[model samples]
Target: MRIAVAAPTGHVGRHLVPMLIRAGVKPLLLLRDPDRLAPDVRPEVDVAEVDLLDADAVVRAVSGVDALYWVDPPPAGHNPLAEYKLATASAARAVTEGGVGRVVFQSSVGAERRHGMGEIDGLAATEVALNATDANVVHLRCGYFFTNLEYQVDAIRAGALQVLLPVNQPMAWVSPRDIAEVAAGRLLSEEWRGRIVQAVHGPADLSWQQVVGIISEAVGKPLEVERIPEEEMRGTLAGFGMSAEQIDSLVGMSTGFLGGFTPEQERSVHSTTPTTLAEWAYTELKPMLQ
Candidate 1:
């Protein structure tokens, strides 16, 4: 049974590769830059060097593999949406042209909407294309990644957390490690067939206020949540030189969340993971601060 992991250097993929190894299954890794793989793991695994943006290349890379873990690489290009569509189209084409039987797509919480989700729309697009195929697919709709806080290193250090969502409203936050575990289970098992939407809701639904308190406790300091206005967020992204479409899409995403756009999949024991904000903060975020 051949299995391959694409974008193996990413947060979840990094964890997924090692988990697959521990399960005694050697996975074929597909990536754009082979050099980015951890030096320690490079000699222990097989790698196919290819540009993910190239559909023909991705098709070739996964051609004979029985299963694949497809996490679209972080959005890039002047138009990230277009880039996302291209990548999804490539993955869809692979299922048809490459003979890959199963795919566990790294999707997001709001992807079920399939429209008006900003950057999440790209993931919805991926879900749409893959769902059209006959191959087994799991739309792993993950929650807001806990790792996103790492981007707040500077902000956290400044004693403030800029949020796009309401501070007191509940929202899901998941660890990437949790996402990898779920993906690995699907890729490793053959019992489940056809397509399904598996939402990863993390350990709990936490409001930004609760999250801020957790981080403050983890770091032994005070932290505050500064709710950034949607239009202001647009200006900030524009200042960062994001494309117009990207800015609108990103602001649109925040607006949706600000409007309390929780996904339809209700929280259940299966959807909830084990890692909590406190655990991730102490283990992952604290170390980054040092």
Candidate 2:
């Protein structure tokens, strides 16, 4: 089977591509810069060097592919919603024009909510657009990525874990590996027809405090969990050179979480993956921190 993977070197795509190759399926990678792909994996899959924003180019990239794994890349500057809409629209057009048989979209947990969701609202919009298309579509509504902790490695090493939300509040988290695994399975099977929504949650819902404790044990050191106020989070993001829109979008996501906005329904047990906080801390987090 021939599959087209957008953002082939991205968080999930990096793992999904290798899994597809191992399954005896060929992947046509849509990469803006093919050089970003690992040298070793380049020989395994077909590469299409094309810009996703260009509708015509995207159509050509997915042409004749049996399935497309579409993941929206992080927004470049400010105005992530606009960026998402533009990219998703182009991709939708491509899926229709290219006659791709199936599509697996990477979305977020709070995407069902319309307001106060920040950037996740963009995923909701993307879902709407993709669902309107004639081809079979599967919306993979994923939870908070455990890999997001990689950004806190420096802070953890300094004995502090900074976050905008309350440490004691429970939140759902998922491993990128699990998301890739589910997407790969759907793409490889290509069986589900029409529209389907799958919630890819982690093994368990955990509080930030519990997660920090696991991190401390993994690194063999005590780490403090510091909660940054929403207003101050804006300043910190600004210091990091994020544009106003980018800062608002990110902070808005945290605000939504603090407000208790989350998935409306319970995720099925079948959708949950086996990776746990302790396991992720020992494997992915520890290696990055050390």
TM-score of each: 0.97, 0.95
Q: Which stretches of candidate 1 lie over 4 Å from their true place?
A: none
Residue-level lDDT of model 1, residues 80-193, one tens digit each, is 788898888888988889998999999998887777778888889888999899899998889989898888899899998877777888888999999999999999999989
Scored by CA lDDT, what does every candidate get? 0.87, 0.85
Candidate 2 has its poorest 10 consecutive residues by lDDT at 258-267
**Pairs of colliding residues, candidate 2:** none
Kindly give the stretch of ten consecutive residues in candidate 1 with the minimal lDDT sum.
251-260
Provide the RMSD of all predictions against the true structure, rounded to 1 decimal.
1.2, 1.4
Give residue 270's lDDT in candidate 2 (0 to 100). 57
> In candidate 2, residue 256 scores what lDDT?
81
Candidate 1: residue 16 lDDT (0-100): 96
Residue-by-residue lDDT tens digits, candidate 2, 1-290: 78999998888889999999999987899888998989989899899998877779999878888899998778885788789888888778988899988999998888888567899888888888888899899999888898888877788889987788888988788988899999999998845799988898888888889888888998899988888878888888899998888987988888887666557657678578988878888887887766
Quote model 2's TM-score. 0.95
Q: Which has the greatest TM-score?
A: 1
